[model samples]
Target: MVDYQIKIENCNSIDCADILIKKGSLNIKYGPNGLGKSTIARAIVSQARNDGSLELLAPFKGRGKAGAGQPKVSGIDGIASALVFDEGYVNQFAFQQDEVVKNSFDIFIKTAEYEKTMLEIEALFAGIKKAFSDNVEIEQTTKDLKELRDAFGKTNADGSIAKSSKLLKAYGSGNKIENIPEVLKPFESFIKSQDPSKWIGWQIKGNEFLKLGDTCPYCSTALPDGPQKDIPLAVAKEYDANAIAHLNTLKAVIERLGKYFSPKGQENLEKITKAKLELTAPEKSFLSGLKTDIEALIAMLEGLRTISFYSLRDVDEIADKIRLLKIDLGMTEKLDSVETRKVTEPINAQLEELIKQVGALKGSINKHKAKIKKAIEENQDSINSFLKSAGYKYSVVIIPEPDSYKMKLLHKDLAGHIDSASKHLSYGEKNAFALVLFMHQVLSDNPDIIVLDDPISSFDKNKKFAILHELFRGKASLRDRTTLMLTHDIEPAIDVIKSKASAFQGASPSATFLSSKGGIVTEVQIKPDEIHTFAKICTEILSAPGDTLIKSIYLRRYFEIMDNVGLAYNLLASLFKKRANPTVQSATESRDMTGSEKSQAVAEIKKHIAEFDYDALVNTVSDDNAMKAKFFATEVGYEKIQLFRIIRGKHEDDVISKFINESYHIENEYVMQLNPHKFEGVPEYVVDECSRLLKTA
Candidate 1:
């Protein structure tokens, strides 16, 4: 810790913060979310930045505090510089769309000048050899295999099939029907037996053959005289009833099923068949399986069409076949799934060959270490080694190249393509990357003072632990720099404060509380936390003097483990009470007396808010009406229902979003200004009274 004394007057939140931060001491400052823990940390950095040498942010001079002409910020003398990781730093380096930070580079003698004499270049290489004697093997390969895989065309199928090519050019091409249905088989047999001419109806002659009266119309020829004589042309109609009726029915069914065999429908079937073949293994199997039913339906239609008119067979199958086809068609997807297949082999083979060639080059060329070009090709070896040692799950390395160095994050995706560090990294991974570089720069520089404002804001639990261990576990890394870590998170804050030691030079830590109200900051004293068991250290620090804003948050953390929300809310209500007027205070106390526990609580909160009586906010949509619309029906529908929306309280939400829209507000927004810690020459009583008011919460 770079020992520095601090005194603030009319700063962002600190009305006056006079404290001596000893050197090499683990000093921690914590508060509740939205209460500007970052403010105090940045204020310290701003003081260090004021020495006129560092191009840094100016200290905060309380803009809202009245009678604040100029701030009297002091006690920052030998502070050379400050390494701060605040919002500004995160915005500039962590999440912008820019080239990812260099993590690795190479060793080579590459000249920047476009043109040079052969002898001049030879002299340069000779000079490199003279300076560096150790041979270093630098492998040139693709940086990110995963990204390269994406760069390869998305299309995979060969598209070389003759049918696909021909069908696309002409829609009608290759259009054909499937197998004729079994239902048509009997009709085909009946059609072959047709001998309608042999029927007695053929012999019938004369108008109606006497309306087919008692006599056999064919034998009417026996009556040679009158109308019946001389073999009257009017013969009998023998088979007309059964054979003609069946034939007509067959014809009707055939017409109904004919659409599948039509030119248009046949063209579509052909497309389906071609698509089936083009699909990936699974999709091809699925489409092929559907062909059985399709073929059976077509066969049924064909059988119906070929039915004989003279003889009858079962045409009962037509309707059933048509129904089956309709059912199948309805179930079929509008678009068939023809997944992709690799048209070409993976590029791994080529990459492997290139790697081999590089190996060969090493044998031919003399192995020698060269002056690494920091300007042109940055050396990320330091960072890469640190990250790898820290258990990063990638074969990260840096290699020298012609103009710039290659940062190979050597890990392939399922498709065997290496992943890009920049192009498509996840949010968590990006956070880790940015933080690693930030720490590397800070520790490598060995700055006198380090101010990290919620550095692990985007980190996971495991990552948070890893960083904490690295910073506080040993004295070797931070032996020279004074570290002041600021966080609203209780766990980490506990860790830093518990590690407090006079071996401040060693592995010990100290802490302070920065409570704020209406954007004015004040440091309060409860008790230096009693030395307690490691398990109880968090509770101890939380007990230290600070605003109820922080204490309420700490209580919430306790409730998470304790599972006593009622107690947590009661405490939270107390914190709100600190800022609430008498009416609002009375409202918070009106919890459920009998049946109206949660409902009463909500009404009281809403009622207190309504007292503000902002017409615009009141006219806004009603949370009650919205609650009824979204969830009331659900409650009635279920057998059991929860009485309270236990998660609906203002701060219960994990995602820190939105202002609570209450007259009593907690200040989360922060501002930075220069010339912090300005001590004003006010009477002791006035300044003392003001300080009491600031810490009263």
Candidate 2:
């Protein structure tokens, strides 16, 4: 069937879409990337593998209810198989040439780019395959961490972490000093009315005054060396012994609390920081905040110590400060503590998963690279033949090195021994290699349909022309087969239309463009390029208001192909003369004829169009006259053509009208001017007339 309609729903970038390919062979669909071009290509291949498996038809990525999201491919009949060549197919067969790493930074940048893609792939997998829920868990954990960090506190206005002070006394009272209690007892009565808290403070002041000797507040000693000779030697040992005993007791309590405040308590935070894990913004800030608090708490504990003599107030202050610190340090699980293993254990588990998944992604890519090398080795001869035919000079030869697997591109030398293809081939050359691989396995094997997406990526103009010629010219040109090609490059597409201009001399090239509007793939009408048959030419000529020159050229050429140029010309010229003015063919004629010209005019027209008296070419027994008569002929040569007319009747006015209009418009335009560069080229009247003629023919 020349016409095939495929309905694509939720397929990759396409939402719910339908594209009608009128004449399927050598069709080229044009669109931008992410516009469902590749989606449609893969869908065709998937359907070929299993028409009934809707799972294959499912879009590679999209959002919807699971099964409901599966794309539906309908109305494909006799499309036995559609093989596809795309970036994905290329990656399966080719590799970059080994090169020296002159710059380490470049490798780092590429690795980062690769990592990003790997993450994206994992996320996609998480969505498609339920078993790959690792990313899902990471995402959820990250989200939870975000909420927690926001609840903790707003960050300092700057992005940098607020540096916590190392000074222990930055908070609470740390003014009390270790001193002898007996030295202060002598002054106890001097401040007897003072409360115990006040008395302890006054007594400490009294001892400092005594250390001054004559100038000290109590003894009023002026000499600095005077107090050294009379220092209380006997009592010092007793105080020293008491201080050591008290130190042991307090140290034990301090040790008990250190487990919760020390770096040991912040194991998860340390691990996350050391891993330099690339978590979300909130997660990073949250961990940083926790680490800062741990450091501040450790600094506070450094100031706590016991003395030989302890005042009641100092002891209470120490106890009260420690309790408050425990709170600040997140030691109490009021709701949930940040440093607690329970809070961070799941996150740590998720972090481990990130590592595993990232590695898995890298492994998967490497595995594909290796597999391509193996596939090339296995299919060398066939692939090389396909390449040479497609205009490449090289043959693929895999050189097995124990250290690494690599493929060498080889070409024949004068002496007949194959040598390396070249020092380096451009990116386009490698892409050509990929196309050759595809052509060998798919197009050369006679698949009913071949869908190539962006087939000439990175291709220069010369390469583009070579590819179009290699694929579309001579016997290699797709004939009696439906080839669907899509590209984002408009220039190449225009060239392709121009290159195939001759083979479809009297027939329209089955080329159309697809545009995505609101995620739907809609066919944009291609004019003049598709106008290719006898009826189309007559309609366009009859309908034109200004210029019918191109259509006239088309009419002559089409009749020539049917071997009826002179005979059909004679009849049409007479009909127009008999009616005076040519009218658009219709059930109700567009207008009544007014006699305009005669046979002299028809003969003059023949002189303008005859191009060496084509009538001479049409005078054989079953000549142009007989062929022209066969349009109304009931027998053999015309049955298939007549059936197309009957099928035209079965469709709605819109479909039939579109088909013929494009056919006539494209064919006529190509004949006169290969480039359809301007608007107002063909009038509306011609459009309707062409539809009318095709319907009748």
Candidate 3:
């Protein structure tokens, strides 16, 4: 397997990081929230997409003009594609409006094998597909149908045109100038020209000039005082420019395409244009019927031209439709354009070819269908079982779509399929489902790298394990692939590496702890033996080589975690408090422990400490000045926090108080805590703040 030492520079909190990832295995990088894990995920995906989005990950302080401090990633040579399961993926692709996951078919069923079969079937019908796309007659006929249909103006349900319809507005109040009024006969030549709309516009513009001066606007001649001055009124009576333009457009369309019209339809069109008043209801009905007929012809042509194995119906039914397609060419030349055979001849040839080879085509298609059906069934069962196993009320059903399949989200407790998955499901539920779907996607896609950026940190313990198993150990999981799971939660490591180690053996999962200091990030590989319970980690720390005060702190926590609040625990607590030992709190007063009790506590403490001395440990811990010096001199972040806690035990300080309130006490007994030295769970800022307080003091 290939090993990657990925280097990232100038990306968010990380100024430079050389992270090692093992190929062909699941790598879990566990760190705190602010260690720039998400930034690493983004940098990897940005480089994979190669879409110039990597520039967005530049550090805010260094984000300026081009090349100022552009984020860079290297050493990921072989990884060309990656799928990231982060909040963005969940919000955008998962829990879509109509399906559980957007493009569910492509993710779940459109396998490379499926595509191979489809390409073979498409190759068999390539001639017809090419004919549909390249035929000039078919192309022109489609354009003609669209042009004719558009002239009718948007029709209503009752076949009556909308009031805003151009046809209705142009012809509802008939303004035909068939017989110009006697008063307007002087300009009859202008109205009778083939391009009368242009002249009507010119006359209308000149009429506006009548309001300005009343001289002939076109000729600049003196106005006649007689009936010639009434010419503007006569022009207005005979023309409306906008209506005339629409009417001219309709007349031109009918003149060019009227040869395809029925004889009765052509006569109706002539009567409608010659009508001196509004068109009769019969004329509108005729236009509506003619529009429907044109749309039907377009549909028939589209069906014939675009035939494929997918669009195949019964052979005879399609043949009859092709044979019955007819158009009236009454009183026109017997042109091939008017005969339906002109469109159907080649299509019929392709159809006959299809009929000859249809058995093989159907067999190939049925094989693919059966394979796809099984995949859908298996995909549905896998997702539904995960939902049920994880105690989710929602289930998924994969339904076949025209081109592919879609997974519908169904809630067992609710009524129908969830229309809005994001709205109906909780944040955890959405993430859970999206993650399972993403696992299948990763398996189907088999990208070079699969990045799950903090995928399961939001889930509780049970759901977290449930999702983890589904993602890495379940059937058709992301096993034996180079996957990076960047998360801030350590429970995943504790579960996958320690508790559920045997279960995830097939996944070949490895884990590491990420820690960032200043601007440089580093990692420590966590072996299965390294992750353990808090009590066990504390015991291990007590036995390892370290400062006595640090060991005492671990011992104190161990006792507390174990509920062993004996004399040794109280004595250590008081020593950290800088109070006299052998003192215990009774009902309301502080009482000294009896000599016998002190002796027994010392014996128990010596069992672990071996060379234990209460006064020596107390003196070491109680010296604030000495502890403050140790805190600065120490390089380890966790050791520094322990030293800071000791130095400010009796002192009232905000930094010390925050550590006490947030992390010091036994808030939860069952919660697993990582070894701070190994995991570096302490934030760098917290250490900085503690050092700041120490320096001021």
Instruction: Tell me, by lDDT, which candidate is best.
Output: 3
Q: Is candidate 1 or candidate 3 better by lDDT?
A: 3
**What is the model-wide C-alpha lDDT for candidate 3?**
0.76
What would you estimate as the lDDT of candidate 2?
0.45
lDDT of model 1 at residue 459?
69
- What tens-digit string does per-residue lDDT give for candidate 3 at 1-697? 6698899998887899889988888899988777889889889888877889998888888766665667999989998899888888888888788988888888888899988988988887776666666566567657766776776778887777666766666666674667567888778787778878888888777777776785788898888887878777777676787777777776676666666555666777677776778778877777677777777767666665555545643343543443443232221222224344555556656666766676677777777778888898888888888888888888888886655578888877777787978888999998898899888888877889999998887787888988888888877788888999998888888888888889998878888988888989999989877766788988887887767777777788889889888788877777777765568754466787777877787788777777777778777777778888788877877677767777865235665466544566678334666677667877777777778878898
Predicted structure 1, TM vs. truth? 0.37
Ranking by TM-score: 3, 1, 2
TM-score of each: 0.37, 0.32, 0.84
Task: Tell me how far the alpha carbon of residue 333 in candidate 2 is from the true structure, in angstroms, after superposition.
Answer: 93
> How far out, in Å, is residue 271 in model 2?
73
On a 0 to 100 scale, what is the lDDT of residue 397 in model 3? 86
Runs in model 3 deviating more than 4 A are: 9-12, 46-72, 123-134, 150-185, 188-231, 234-242, 262-289, 309-340, 400-405, 544-546, 586-597, 632-636, 650-661, 668-674, 677-679
* Each model's Cα RMSD: 27.6, 22.6, 4.5
lDDT for 335 (candidate 3): 21
- 1-697: candidate 1 lDDT, tens digit per residue: 3466677554444455565566766566654455545556656666676654211222355345665544445677777678876656655654333234432221112233212322332332342232222222101011121121122213225422222222222211211112212333323333234443233234333436645554545445434446434223322211232333333333333334333233544444444433412334443333233333334433432322222211111223332332332222323332122210010012222223333343332322222222333422332544444445556654444544443444455543333324445555666566666665566556545677778777775665567656665555532245445777776554554444443333233545665555554445554421235323322432543545532323333343344334444632443443333312112223356442233443444343333232222222222213434333333332211100110121133332222113222101223312111011121111222223323332342
Rank list by lDDT: 3, 2, 1
